[model samples]
Target: MIELRDAAYDYGGGGLALRGLDLSLAPGSFHFLTGPSGAGKTTLLKLLYGELRPTGGAALLFGSDTRAMDRDGVSDARRRIGVVHQDCRFLDHLPVHDNVALPLRVAGGDVASRADDVAQLLGWVGLGARMHARPPELSGGERQRAALARALVMDPDVLIADEPTGNVDWDMSQRLLTLLAELNRMGKAVIVATHDLALIRAAKAQVAARVLRLSGGALSAAGADL
Candidate 1:
């Protein structure tokens, strides 16, 4: 659904965060993005979701060049891609269910009519009983699952999770990985950006995935050791 051809991004004077990175994400494909801090994993994710267009090469969303897309075009393209940032950014004042539904509301979706769908999504993420709870009340694992639910609310074709298991313990991380694997089984393209080798290894046992490492402004297939 998305393709990056020799994609490159520069933060003005900061130099290129990413360069000559080529990638293609097809339906039901699974990928793991790994690198050290400041390796441009997040920058690559932004490019995939249309948050930042590539300055040097083409980044395409559903066949349209990101650089050529107008505001509305970019916005429309983003609706097909769901992102879970490292920090689960939820409105503390809103109930868990409300936060999950926020994207739909923002997209002008009829929240009232989609109540059942929203509740079902929460249940899918194992948060059915915590729907009424506030964000601050959730445990780290619960918060991550809630974030996943929120990302899936739009039923996007691709799911991009950045360091999804970073804060959770081993067991929780495994749980989250299983959830992601299950989603892939259901035919959603999944790209998880994490530095945890253990997490990636554990995932390999559960799903077939391409491990890509970003370093020195370039991307390459990870070796078997990964």
Candidate 2:
């Protein structure tokens, strides 16, 4: 459902983040993007979700060229893809339940309409008790879970995460990976970008995950194993 053909990105004439990178993500596939710091992992994810257009080459998402899409079109396209960011930002004044339900709310779906479903989803992510708590009151792990819940609220066809496990402990990281694996089994394409090799290794044990390492302005596959 996603393809990048000979993609290259240049930020303000700086070093190229990706050069002549070719990648395709089929439905229900699971992938882990790994690299050292400043290896362009985040840049790749941004291109995938249409946050940044490629400077050279082509990127197709759901068969539409990202470069040709208008702002509203890009936003609509993103609705089909969910994203969990490393820094989960939320409205501090809103309760956790409201914050987690913001996606549906902003999309014109009634928040009150899906209240029970939101509660259930938050519970699944181990954030049931924090529903009434504000975002500022949540711990790092709790905030991460809330962000995951928000991302999945739309039942997106694809899920992309950047450094999802960066702020969590090892045990929490395992829990998050477990949840993502289950989502992949349910047919959502999953892609995670992380610098944590151990977490990538653990995810490999649970799913058929291909490790793609970005380095020196190019994207290439790592070894066959995790």
Candidate 3:
């Protein structure tokens, strides 16, 4: 549950990235946001996750204005949302499983009690055997899946993936899309921001997902063809 009401964000230096954005995401809903480079797709995701507060209008998460929240409030709000960045920034020195478990560790979770969960998630992402591999040892697809597993380690209510299929091949992109669709079926609200029209179209066939486009600092519904 995230809502933006006529939200406007100025990036300072006399530049406005978002202006008068009105978007709403309900529970269990899946959405795909596509746009050109510098179209503010990532900025929109940051707004939903409490990383960026709106400068002019309302940016609400589960009914609360993000600008009104304190530091702890923002931190707690993030626990309900999982984010997968395009870069898949994993610790180079840590094993894959440990990297996946880092979120829980940072949140002060009793990781020992949930070791099986980490393993299960890795298996779900088709990376069970590579648990002991380091980040440098993983392929691009493997790295993406590992990042997804790490994000889901928190069991977040909402999942925000930014250009998730960017670095993978077509087949691997389809696989990742299927995994995201499955999550939507399991009731995790999903928002995938990507530039790949093919990936978005493929995902639409697997799940009931809305495609939105960001252009000139605004959001609008787009056709499946993109």
All-Cα superposition RMSD per candidate: 1.1, 1.2, 1.3
Model 1 misplacement above 4 A: none
Native-to-model Cα distance after best TM-score fit, residue 133 in candidate 3, in Å: 1.4
Q: Sorted on lDDT, highest at the top, how do the candidates line up?
A: 1, 3, 2
Model 1, 1-226: lDDT tens per residue?
Answer: 8999999998988765788999999999999999888898999999999999998899999999999999999998888888888899999999999999999998999999998998999998899999999999999999999999999999999999999999999999999999999999989999999999999998889999999999998999998897
Shift of residue 168 alpha carbon in model 1, Å: 0.6
Q: Which stretches of candidate 2 lie over 4 Å from their true place?
A: none
Tens-place lDDT digits, model 3, residues 54-89: 988988888889999888888888888888989999
For candidate 3, the clash count comes to 0
Can you give the lDDT of residue 59 in candidate 3? 87
Indicate the residue-level lDDT of 172 in model 3: 97
Q: Give the winner by lDDT: 1 or 2.
A: 1
Per-candidate TM equals 0.97, 0.96, 0.96
Candidates 2 and 3 compared by lDDT, better number: 3
Whole-model lDDT values for every prediction: 0.93, 0.90, 0.91
> What lDDT score is found at residue 201 in candidate 2?
81
